[model samples]
Every structure is written in C-alpha cells, then in structure tokens.
Target: MKPLHRLLALALAVSMPGGVALAADLRVMTSGGFTAAYQRLGPQFAAASDNTLSTVLGPSMGKAPQAIPNRLQRGEPADVVIMVGYALDELIRQGKVAADSRVELADSRIGLVVRAGEPKPDISTTAALKKTLLAARSVAYSDSASGVYVERQLFEKLGIQAQLAPRGTMIERIPVASVVAKGDYQVGLQQVAELLPVPGVTFAGKLPEDVQSVTRFAAGIPTGAQHPAEARQLLDYLASPQVQGTVQATGLDSVPR
Candidate 1:
C-alpha cells in the first residue's frame, strides 16, 4: 500500500476497538534504533487495546548502564524487549528470553549527519564517503553495532584505519547526531532511525551500500515476564505490516514477512 493509504488504514485501526481480551500493563525495553516507530505505534496499540505501556530506552549492546542486556541482567521489570536481533538472540542463548517469542520488526541502516545549517557532505558513493571522512576534522559514530562496524571493520575495509584513527570517536549512550549537532564532531554516523530524530543536525545520507551496516531490530518476550500474553500482542503489533508506513517514516525499512 502507498504511504497515505497505510497511514489511513492504521488510523482506522487505531480508532476501532482492539481485539485483546483484557487490559494489561506492559513494560517495554527498546533500544534507540527502533524507538521512534515504537513510540509512535505503541500508543496506538495501547489506546486501541486499553493497555498501558511503560517504556525504557537503551542501547542494543555496549557496556553502557542502560544497555538492554544489562537492564535484563539486572532483572529490570519488562514484558517485552526490542533491540538489535543478535543482541536479542544473545538473551535467548543466555536463557533470559524465550527463543519462540522472537519477532523481526525492521532493518535499520547507518547514515551520516552534520550539525544543522552545515553543508551536507557527499556520501553518494564509497569513494565519496571515504573522501568525506578523510576531510573531516573529527568523525563520530555510535558505540553500538553500526559504530562497531565502522570502527572495527569499515575503516579497515576502506584501508584508512591508520589515517582516520586519531580523529574518530565512539559516542556512547546517546545519539551520534546529538554530538554532531553540538559541534563536538564534524560528522557523525549511526543508525538512520537514531539519526533522523535528533534536532540541529542535517542528514547527509546513508553510507555506500557496500559499507552500510544494517541492524535488524527484533523483539522478544523475556523469561519471567509478568505479562506474557500482553507482550505477544505488542510484538504482533510491532511486526505487523499494517503499520509499516509509520515504520518507514522513522527511517526503518520493514523486514520482509
């Protein structure tokens, strides 16, 4: 369906009564990459179903105190978790989450940002992206998956690891664009969904296809969840094609069903 049609469909759905049998309170722990869409769609589900949501925002990985895994390891109360697919799988492997509860929600690609009002740099091709990096006074990336790829693999892939080493930074527990917007860095790279929401930054465009890091955002019900059935209802809502236009609007591409 077209964007408009999808939005209208979702609107109609939200306006109608929901199918869940009873109202429940759901605790959701979601990482930054998928937060935008979740924030938008979550309330729709809640309003339609008469459930209430308590959301906690965090990263999919890294040692940050608010990282989703750390939150889970600490036994934070949560019914469902939305994060990078691999991270959710790690939770499953650790027996913190149920493998059968997993559902793929979206794929988020890495993109560039410069402080708002600054000229957007060229990242139209691999060579152009490299050139922009080389010319940058300082480059910032997240401490999450996309940054891991850029810091540990992409520079080596571009064969500029040594040259870019001194000027690169790994931003933690916050949006890369936030730093770029504050003039702390000349350019920043992070999941496109994470980048587009921050103010005072201009999106430069995604990295070249060959170098792009696309993280799959998936959700799962954690073991010992107090509201398993309600969590499944939310998981179904998030992964549903019915609200995909809102997902794309948040810079996430819907995963193929």
Candidate 2:
C-alpha cells in the first residue's frame, strides 16, 4: 500500500487551502487615465488584503464607448473594471459586470496644457476658447472620449470646425501632453487628470463653464469574479476619504455621491 499512501499524500498537498500558492489573484482591467492612481493604490491593496492585483492598462481610445466592450466581447479575463460611469452602466446592462458592485470613485474634467514657460492663453469662455483654437498653429487632442466629444460636438458648436480640420491632429495611444512637449502641437487638450502627469507641460485650466464636460469614473466587479470579496475591499479602499484626497490632487474631483 506504499504507492497508494504516496498518492494520498500528493492529493493532500495539492488540495491544501490558505496557502500562498492558492491565494486569490484579482485581475483588473482599467483605462490609461487611472494609471497614476492605480500605481499608488495597487500595492496598498495587496498589502492590506494579502491578495494579488494584476492590472491591465488599456488604451484610452473610446475608453467608455468601444475599447471596454470590445475587450469583454473578446473574452478578456477581468475580476474588476474601472472606467467612466456611463460605460460601466452600459456594461451592467450588457451583463458583463455585476450591477450591484458599482461604486463612483472620482470625476475628471477636460483641460488644456501648453509647454512649460509658454505664455498661457485665454480659454475662459466659449468665444474666447474658439479664438484660441483658431489662433493655435497646430492643436493636439486625444482620440478618446473627451477628444471625440470635443471634435464632434464642441468644435462645431463653436463654429471653427472648418478651420481646425485641415491642421489639427488627434493623437491615439500616447498622451496629448507628450505631443505638446515635443512641440508637435501648440496646445494639448485632454482630461485634467491625464494632462497633469506628463512632464514638460503646464496645465492651462479646465474648459469654460458652459462647455465643460465632466466624466465620472467608477469601479465594478465582473459578474463572474472569482474573488468578489477581495474586489469589493479594493473598491472600498479606492473610494475612501483617504484616497479621495490623492484623487483630487491628481486633477480629478472627488465624487460627490
């Protein structure tokens, strides 16, 4: 019975629970805009919960509209997802995420940036902002949600669509701040949170009052998440008051609700 005893020992070893080898790994899929916040919080979450977080940073292109849905349809594994509130709601309706697991984290507003030491231009009103855009040699913006909104709706509303069409450029994958830093464009426009992180660029300010658009960011657990409890804990930590200050310092507003 020596061989049978050996087989039982192997089974015991493999089936053992509460071991480091068997610890849960929470896989998270997030947009590039949240990179800085996650970099700070991921390690804290791991240390507090004794669970591992594996993050996948996706491009900002259609962050809410297309990229997320495409990734879910492609069968990407994600225990948790962090993105715009409207997008998360859509995913909930599509049955990709747990409807009850949603939690609002922060709010981001669109802003402009110019190379450090450059003279800051006025964009305090719709008319003034339009003039600034027209006067710029070449403007750079993202290919993501904010950029799309600006290009499709705001510019047309401002009556300068024709002027920017020929010379303006939309950057994808890379941050708009980088484009401004390289002198490829006279000004960069993106979420305030995104523009603040890149070096060599100084924030001008958020868009004017009437035209300003704020995107609410949130986190949700996938419906079939293997570590739902751990995911909830991480979400709680992110939305806590302690984390909210960091969120605000990054140019995002604290979620009011």
Candidate 3:
C-alpha cells in the first residue's frame, strides 16, 4: 500500500478501538539504527492505540557495558526490545525474551561516512576500501554489530587488520557517524540507517556487496513484560505493511513477513 493509504488505514484502525485499553503504557528498548522509524511511527501508534511509549537507546553489542543485554541483565524494565536478531535470540535462549514473540523488522547494511563537504573516499571494492582504511588518519566504527564486523572480520577479509588496528576507533554504545560528523574521527563506519540521521556527515556508500554485512533487526517481547499483549500489539503495528515505507525512509529495508 502507498504511504498515504497506510496512514489512513492506521488512523482508522486506531480510531476503532478493540483489544487492550489505550491507558496502558509500554516501555521499549531499541538500537540506534531503527530509532528513526520508531520516532516517526511511534507517535502514530500512540495516537491510535491511546498508549504511550517510553524508549531506551543502546547498542546491540560490544563492551560498552550498556548494551541491550547488559541493560536487561541489570533488570531494566522493558516490554519490547528491537535490536539485532542474534542479540534478541541470545536473550530468548537465556529466557529473558519470548522466543515465539520474535518478529523480524528490517535489514541494515554497513556504510561509510565522512565529515560533510570533505572529499568522499573510494570504497567501491574490497581493495579500495582496504586502502582507504589503511590510509585514514582516524577511523571510527560502532561498538555494535557493524563495528564487530569491521573489527573482527572486514579487516581480516581485506588482509589489513594489523595496519588498521592502531588507529581504528571503536565508538562504544554511541553512534559512530555522529563522532565523524563532529570531526572527532576522519571516517566512520556503521549501519547505513544509523549514518543517515546524523548531521554533518556525507554517506560514502555501503561496503561492496561481497563484504557487506546486512544485519537483520528484530523485535521481541520480554518475558517479564508488564504488558505482553499490548507489547505484541505494538510489535504488530511496527511490522505492519503500511509502515514499510517509513522503514525504508529511515535507511532500512523492511523484511517481508
């Protein structure tokens, strides 16, 4: 459906209330990459469901000590979590989230970012990317999924791990593109969606097809959720076909349910 049609349909669906009362409040924990879509769709969900959303932002991995799992381990209250699929799967295995409640939302690919107006470097191929990395005065990547790939896999694949490590910066629990936008780092690598939202940065492009890691972002209800049913409703709303455009607009490719 077109975006306008989807919006109208959603408005109508919410206007004709059915299940759970709108008075229920929901707490959601989501990674940075999907926040743009959540921010756009959240208000509409609230208007329709008559419920409020409380969101927490954090990375999906690394040693930030505040990644989603760490937050959940610390007993942070959340009804739903939107993060890298594998991370959510780990939570499900640990019995922190409902296995059956998992819903795949979108696919994200790693991209490069440079300070706005700076000369964009070539990353059109694995070799060019390797050279770019080797020459960058300072390079930053997230402490999240993309960073893990850049740190543990990409360099090895490019045969330049040793050369890049000394100057490679792992941005812990924060958006790598944001730091690059501030000129704190000469180049930044992170999910395309996460890079698009930050100001003062120009996206160089996704890593070459062969080397790209397209991370799947999914959502699940927490086992200890205060409002599991309502959380499911919110998840349904998020994964609804009508919002696929919103997902794509945020630099993610919506997963077909």
Question: What is the lDDT of every predicted structure here?
Answer: 0.89, 0.78, 0.87
> Looking at model 3, which ten-residue stretch has the lowest summed lDDT?
12-21
Looking at candidate 2, what is the lDDT of residue 4?
30
User: Which scores higher on lDDT, 2 or 3?
Assistant: 3
State the number of backbone clashes in model 1: 0
Q: What does candidate 3's lDDT look like per residue over 1-257, in tens digits? A: 54554564465456445822545689999998788899998888777666789988888765666688999999999999999999889999999999999999899999999999999999999888988888899999988889889999998898888888898988888788889988999999999999998899999999999999999999999999998877887887788887898899989998856
Error of 3 at 174 (Å): 1.5
How far in Å is the alpha carbon of 33 misplaced in model 2? 3.2
- Best by TM-score, which number? 1
Of candidates 2 and 1, the better by TM-score: 1
TM-scores of all models?
A: 0.92, 0.84, 0.92
Pick by lDDT: 1 or 2, better one: 1
Best by lDDT: 1
Residue pairs with backbone overlap in model 2: none
> Per-residue lDDT tens digits of candidate 1, residues 58-128?
99999999999999888799999999999899999999999999999999999999999998799999999
Question: Which run of 10 residues does model 2 get worst, by summed lDDT?
Answer: 4-13
Query: Each prediction's Cα RMSD?
Result: 3.9, 9.2, 2.8
Predict model 2's lDDT versus the native.
0.78
